[model samples]
Target: MKLPESQVAALNAASATDETPIDRLAEEAGLKPETATQAVFELRDEGLLEVTERESVEYELTDEGAEYVESGLPEVRLYRTAVEAGTDDAPAQMGRIIGASGLEGPEIDIALANFGRKGYGDIDSGELSADPDADADDDPEAAALAALAEGGAVDDVDADVLDQLVSRNLLDRHERVVRTITLTDAGVTALMEGIETAETVDRLTPEMLTSGEWQDVEFTEYNVEADAPEVRGGKTHVLRQTAERVKDVLVGMGFQEMEGPHADADFWINDCLFMPQDHPARTHWDRFALDVPPIEHLPEDLVDRVESAHREGVGEDGDGYHSPWSEDFARAVALRGHTTSLSMRYLSGTEVGELEPPQRYFSVEKVYRNDTLDATHLLEFFQIEGWVMAENLSVRDLMGTFVEFYEQFGITDIQFKPHYNPYTEPSFELFGKHPTTGELIEIGNSGMFRDEVLEPLGVEHDVMAWGLALERLAMLTTGAEDIRDLHGTLADLDFLRGAEVTY
Candidate 1:
């Protein structure tokens, strides 16, 4: 059978029974000296020939291989040389010969022996056979086909089987230089036509075209090219929509609307409402007090009652809880933290009369707080506040107002827990179902008009006041993931942008 080129060349390098240097042998054989010497050792071990250690090792094929070499036709080599010379059918022809099917183990073995004799498929160790344990059962031919698919025979081939295949005219055994991988003209055409293999080409057929399913789907071969439907238009933020809905409800309910300056002096905001000058809620952390101040002038008449209430409570012998009132504190400009400040302005001025003796009023305004912002806290937000006052209104009226307001928002799960605000006695805090977090969250705080503050304003009986935090309600309504979006900053106002106002 055909010997490895290195083995033949090494034998040629050794001359006349005298030692020829292994390095020189390697040079003649186009191999490293270590490779040449190792080939010599292999030939001797296979009983091809033996050379003394004192003399250099020489090599030759064994008797069986010699007999194979003489019998295999020279045309066998001529067929391979002619095929290799013709590039047109080389790859396909090579593929067929390499993956010869129906050759059982022993016949395939005989073919391998004949291949070596013909000098057609002789490759290096890293050329044909796959891993070390490759067997006929393992389908080395299929593995070689895969290797050719990726590129010329890969580095993962085994030396012995690769040499046999290359000798058999399957793989082109060009081992003098590194094999290169470049897309061939045929390969490029195949790729453009979306064909890689039988399986891939099978996917394109007249039956597939007849169904016209491709017409229903967008074909973005390179980039996403499906045109999206044109977005409609802009909208108000959900919180703003909520505030608007609250206002709509109040107005629809015949409650006259009222508003005051956003930067109202604390006097109009708090002192007018009989908040004791010493109340803890007035502290710095909870409230955003204006740094710049002359505490704007309190209403002359309201000031008299507010001041008197500070010294000796409101009416005769009331709670007797009075603290010195400060013109400075009352006039400091602040970010309004509660819509109730507008309510105070209503009670302290001509709006009080505009509301008949039995009157209702409401406001949906932004409020600011100074608390640490968290999942449920924001320095700025909205408040839905409302009140109805008449002779002898009771806690029942407060309940009615709360239920009505929440129902308007489609909120059914709400609990009015007993709470106390310094300005309201018998106060209750509103809590409602959180839409996403699924926890009960506080909405706002409200309570009846206390005798202490109302008497000073001159309405002595009970009046209902109720307020709910706007973000909590807005979150419930809009399924917002974060509270920051409520303040008009996180993203565009989706509420107004796409809202059909219900209230």
Candidate 2:
């Protein structure tokens, strides 16, 4: 029998009695893993080898995990400190124990959270108690971390402990397919009869063509059904592709693109949109404030008009918040919570030279917020911001626009619930039915700008504007259950690689 050189080597290296891993077989055959893999598949096709695949999980300590392994898990450290502080005998003041524990900032919270969960102690009404029977040295999480750090098998660790470590961002788990190759009876028979290496050409070269030897050489057969190595080539991210599609769709709907600073003056981000100076959303907890110098150059007349709108109202029928609006606060810089700042800038005629009535402008840009990370929320994500300025615009026009816009993405079952926004009158929150869960998810927010908002921006004509979440739109299109799956630290690479941003 004759075979390719790589196949001959693999068969010679494979064992008849023991199943050898593909990696070890490749090492013994002095061949690359991919070459050995292809050869193994070819031999298996001819019933000369048996190939089986098994999935193995590997665990590695994250940076935080390594730190904890070096200097005790936060909970364990807190427990030891609490025991030394006599908390086991009597409840001690939580602050003193925590201070003595030397846990600072986020670590203190981590310690307190896990301290109670590990049955190490109890925290109640600003006091901490330790369980005398609970041994801090026997913590499963800490033991698991130490085992992983020392290259122990994943099976040696408790599953729940591993899960807890993963949830705490202290460990990373990865699964890999391990393939093993074993010789079949046919393979042993072939080896006993002796096999020869066949000279075969997989590709026709220019030299072969010039020498006219292509016809004389045997061409290697291709096994298209073989499990080949995965090639993850560079391509546009699904989110970016969706964002680009959005831009194209908006442009087709007769809207021009808008662009501006990601971090800008609060004046354009909020105050220009009639958000009161003292609004809760303006506080540091909700916005990423910057320490840069205040905005020195603002249109003085526009500022006066905006302040007057905040102080005295827009029209005779309009009413202002009458809050103490401060120019200093408005000039403060921060990351834009929404791309509505671009809308504010464009509508105020500061961008694109004062867009005229019957103008449409849109921006698919990133926004930052101090939001809690969850399945539906992210601290930073793209926002699809847009506005239409024309006379006699009504709620019907707003709803019709959304219908047409979403239909392009095959989302026809959009539901809108009346909501409230500080700048938009009769605001509506747009919801879309999830393709997988069959549940309605809030996708975006929209409404017509109120007189307090539009009048301050010098937009006399009725203007309808919306700040839609780009990630949520992507989630709806991709059938992703979690926004984190789309793009974030916890993103699923497999999902991203396979997700098609279908229109």
Q: TM-score each candidate.
A: 0.52, 0.79
lDDT of 2 by residue, 101-134 (tens): 9999778756765677678978765578999999
Cand. 2 Cα-lDDT = 0.88
**lDDT of each residue in 89-168, candidate 1, tens digit only:** 33233224434433343333344334333343432221222122212224453355445544553556666655544433
lDDT score, candidate 1, position 237:
53
Off by over 4 Å in 1: 1-232, 291-297, 352-354, 488-503
Candidate 1 structure lDDT:
0.57
